[model samples]
Target chain A: MATSSLLLLLADGRFPAGAHAHSGGLEAAVAAGRVTDLVTLEAFLAGRLATAGLVGAAFAAAAHRAVTSAGSAVRGSTLALLDAELDARTAAPALRTVSRRQGRALLRAGRAIWPEASFDDLPSTPGGAHQPLVLGLLCAAAGLSRAETAAVAAHGTVTGAASAAVRLLGLDPYQVQALLVGLASRCDGTAAEAARAADEPPERLPAAAAPLADIHAEAHATWEVRLFAS
Target chain B: MRAYARLVARADGRGGTVLAELRGETPLLLRQTPGSGRAVTVYVVGGAAGPLAGDDLRLEIDVGPGAAVRVHTVAASVALPGRPDVVSRMAVRAVVHDGGALHWLPEQLVAAAGCAHLAESRVELAAGARLTWRDEVICGRYGEAPGGAVVHTRVDYDGRPLLRQSLAVGPGAPGWAGPAVLGGAPATGSLLVVDPSIPHETAAVEGTLARLPLAGGPATLWTATAADAHTLRDHLDVEVEPLLTKVE
Candidate 1:
């Protein structure tokens, strides 16, 4: 399979990764009136992309590097450390559950698409593997490069939230697409930066944090009726 | 100026806890008194002024087995710039032994205008050790913009990585007032509790984060805003007591 086709397949919103159930904290932001218009929605997407997106891409790229750099034998310990590192980066319990839930779904899909030894060695987390960690392992199984893994990581981080914004707030789709188009260049740049750090140790991975998002996730978890799971 | 403070709380062998060692400066004050259920409450008072530029302040605290220590600050610690192109730093290291608990609820640390400050804290805990820690930061004085401040926090329980995060804001920092970041809030507070034995749903929702399950164990993290240090302290007092009492 061509690399571009593989990237499209993974990045597709309909990848059956269980990402649909999560609003990526957009539901909370909407309820709080933080994202009322197209401009606020753009700011939310960009901020999330820059912080959580970059961090996720870095970890995913590192996980992919861990498999490809080792030439065939997947090190369980390295994968385990990567899992722990991602866990450290995430501060909200609700967000971690969302990540693990999506990760389990992705792993289920990956095992069906490409059953490989690297995927077999994924460390067992309490909830499950983080979504990005599992995505990286799937990329390794698909023979995708580190940069592609990061692009997938960064692109998915904000795009899913943008889609959620549309459903939650009934925002104009054309305007949201424009916002996404405007952010495409920066998204690529973030992915490049994350891919460059793929060779760094697990502890050295990017730890960009969004404090408000973590707080919103916490509040959203307590809501009796929320549109998205996260 | 370089200053240091070390506090060690040990079991008095009489069904109570006592301060083993206490040493510091005016910038870091300590007053120990008997508290509820084998715990000693220590009130930390700041001096007339906080650490100036070029001042290195280091604080170390340890809790022995079967001991409980609770530390509270009287007022907020404001970091003032000493000289041009210089930064002030506050380093705190704490440890809790097995079957012990340490709760340090300090007031906000305000970064004065034009001042650069770095506040770093590392907490290491043994198995069965419980900790309820809270820290907050204010951008600057009221009616003023934020300065340069970076808060780095790391925690380990039973030799496992729990949480390691660095929050940077102000000029030239990423996500200054963005919606997904601080949402234009001037003050931010974080409360972390490291104890897995307690039931996860026990944390009452008072402020930002009610119950956040950290990776190392069942920890509660609340990062939100307040009007000032006093208001933030009041918000934390109501939320923190419920979580702190659950350690035993």
Candidate 2:
């Protein structure tokens, strides 16, 4: 399969990876009045792209490197460490649970579509392996490169949240699409940076954090009623 | 140009005591608190005109097994752009051995307007060790716009990464006051607690507004922002000191 087509498939918001249920904390931001308008939404997306987006991309790229690189015997430990590292980078308990749920969902899709042995090596966490780790495994099954995995990770990170913003805030879809178009270059740059660091040790991966987003995720978890899982 | 301080704590049957101490310009003063023989409190005092341009301050702290150490600063250390030729920097490294504990609560770091300062702190903890650390930063003096300040902190527990953060706040920083970043707050305070004994999701948040789970082991990083540095520091202390002192 062509790499771009496979990337397009996985990067699609409707991939059935269960990403639809999550607003990527956008619901919480909207509820908090921080994302009331288009300009603020843009700021939220830009910040998310830099922090969570970059971290997810780096880990996904690193996991892809682990699976694609030589030494098949160490793949198990490498993937396990990647899962734990991603868990550590995620600061919100609710986000951790959401990531694992999303990871399990993606794994179900991967097992059905790819049926690769690399996915079998990923140990199940109390929640599940982080979404990025599972995404990396699925990418390896599709014969995608590390950079492609990073792209998938980075793009999915913002697109899910952007789509969530549309549903929550009822913004103009065309404008949101245009904003995403403007962010395309940033997505490419972030993926490249993540792929470049893919060879680094798992512990040395980038740890970009959004403190407010984390706090919001925690608050979102306790809500009696909400639109997003995280 | 370079100031250094080292503090080594040893378990003395009942509690921990400062075993070896060394200092250059920024000295560490050891104080004894009531009812705790093993617990020692350290105060970082500045010499002369505080931290100036081109000055580098280094602090190394170690807590032995079964020992406890608490550290605080005398007063706010102003980072002045005396020469304007170089940036003032402070680097701190700390370690807690198995079953040891350390509580490091420092006063506000006032980065005066137009000055540039960089502060980095790294902490390592053994499997059974515990640490409660707090840091407060005032971007600039009261009623003034922020200068330039960057704080980078990393914590590792049992050789596993716990938390790592780089906060750059000042003019020209992208969205520094936006809701995604500091949310228009002038001062920011952070509390990092890494301890297994503490129950998960156990945090009492008051005054300040933000709390998040830490990455490594059983830890939580609580952050609060307020109109001024004093209020921010109060928020950090209110939520964190109880947890740290309970280790005794």
Candidate 3:
């Protein structure tokens, strides 16, 4: 498959990566009334993009670099280091579980689709490998560039929450798409930044965080009934 | 101006801890406050005014095996504005040996308007070490707008990464106060506890507060935002006070 077409496929929301089940913390924000309409939703997505989006994209790009640049002998250890560093960046246990759950799902998909890829290099943690690390490996296997991997990661960070906003708030689909379109440049810029920073060591990668989102995620996990898993 | 301070606590073998070495410079004075029991308390008093822009400060804390030390500041350290293009910085490095404990509970750091301050802390914990680290930031004083301030913290447990985060607010940080970040609250603080004895469970959110367990180890992080510093402390204390008592 053409690399560009493959990028589009992996980034698609319809992909069976289990991303469709999580709201990226939008459900909690909506439940708290902190995100009531399109304006607040835009702010939420922008904030998420700047903090969580940036960090996740950076780690993904770094992981891509690890698998592609390192020899097979050291690839597993490098990937494990990246996973541990990303775990450090993610403070919320619920968010961690969600990321690993999604990672497990994505790994299953990657193993079936690209059976010959180096999927076995992923660290076998208690839950699973982090979603970003799995994404980086899969993107690398698909012949995608590091920048493209970061873009895919950054794109999912906002799009998942944006899609959830549509269902949770019942907002206009057109308006939501427009909001995403407005954020496209930012997503690209963040991806580029993340890709550039990927050259650094794992500990030096972006660690930007959204504290309120972490709080919201923990609360959302406890909800008896919710529209999304996180 | 530039200054560096160092403090070392060692187990006295008398069911208590004592300061093995205490040194301070002009703007970073160290004072031992009277306290009883196995833990030693130290107050960080400012000998001179301002960690103003253009000032550089460094602090080193080392806790010997089985030693317990609690460090607190006498008052909030204000990041005052100085010459343009110059930034003030405070870097703290700490190490806790096996079975040692350190409670770093400092006062709020006020980032005054037009000031550029960067505070960074790196903590290393050996096996069986316990830590209670607290940090609070007040964006601005009175009616002024906040300046640029970044609080970066990295904690390592048993030589592995546990928590690493950098929170940048005001000026250069565009969307810091947005709903997903601080939600426009000027007062933000977090308490990090690395105690293996605590049960592993998630805590509920109380208002703008939430306590989360770190994934890599037996650690919990409590974060909160409030309209003001006083309320921020109250919110943090609701969850942190109990944990501190357990440490004692």
List DockQ, one per candidate, in order: 0.47, 0.38, 0.72
lDDT leader: 3
lDDT per residue for candidate 2 within A1-230, as digits (tens), equals 59889888988988988898998878887887888877887778877877788889998898888888847799888888888777767766677788889999999999999874568678656777888988988898888889899999999988998888889989999999998898899889999999998888887787766667667777777789987777
Compose the digit string of candidate 2's lDDT tens values, residues B81-187.
Answer: 76666788889999999988898888888878877788888899999899988877787887877677777787889988787766767753445566666666788
lDDT of model 3 at position A158: 97
- Return the lDDT, model 3, position A224: 94
lDDT of 1 by residue, B1-248 (tens): 77788899998998788888987886776777656777888888775476677778889999999888888888878888787787788899999999888988887788888778888888998988988888888888988877787788878778777787777767745455678877777777777777767666532344443445676666766666666766666666776787666553
Ranking by lDDT: 3, 1, 2
Candidate 3 lDDT over A1-230, as tens digits, reads 59989999999999888899999988988887888999999989988998999999998899899999999999999999999999999988888888899999999999999999998899989899999999999999999999999999999999999999999999999999999999999899999999999999988888987789888888888889887878
CA lDDT scores, all candidates in order: 0.80, 0.79, 0.90
Runs in model 2 lying further than 4 Å from the true structure: B14-16, B26-37, B48-55, B77-88, B110-117, B143-148, B170-173, B202-215, B244-248
Candidate 3 structure quality by residue, lDDT tens digits, B129-209: 999999999999987788898999999999889999988888777578778888888999899989878788766677888
Chain A TM-score (model 2): 0.97
Superior by DockQ: candidate 1 or candidate 3: 3
Compared with the true structure, model 1 gives a TM-score of: 0.86
Off by over 4 Å in 3: B243-246
Rank order by DockQ, top first?
A: 3, 1, 2
Q: Which wins on DockQ, candidate 1 or candidate 2?
A: 1
- Candidate 1, residues A1-230, lDDT tens digits: the string is 69889999899899988777777778888887888888888778878887888889998898888777765455677888888878877877677788888899999999988864458677876778888888998988887889999999999988899989889888889888899999999899899999998888777777766787887887887889877888
lDDT of model 3, residue B176: 82
Clashing pairs in 3: none
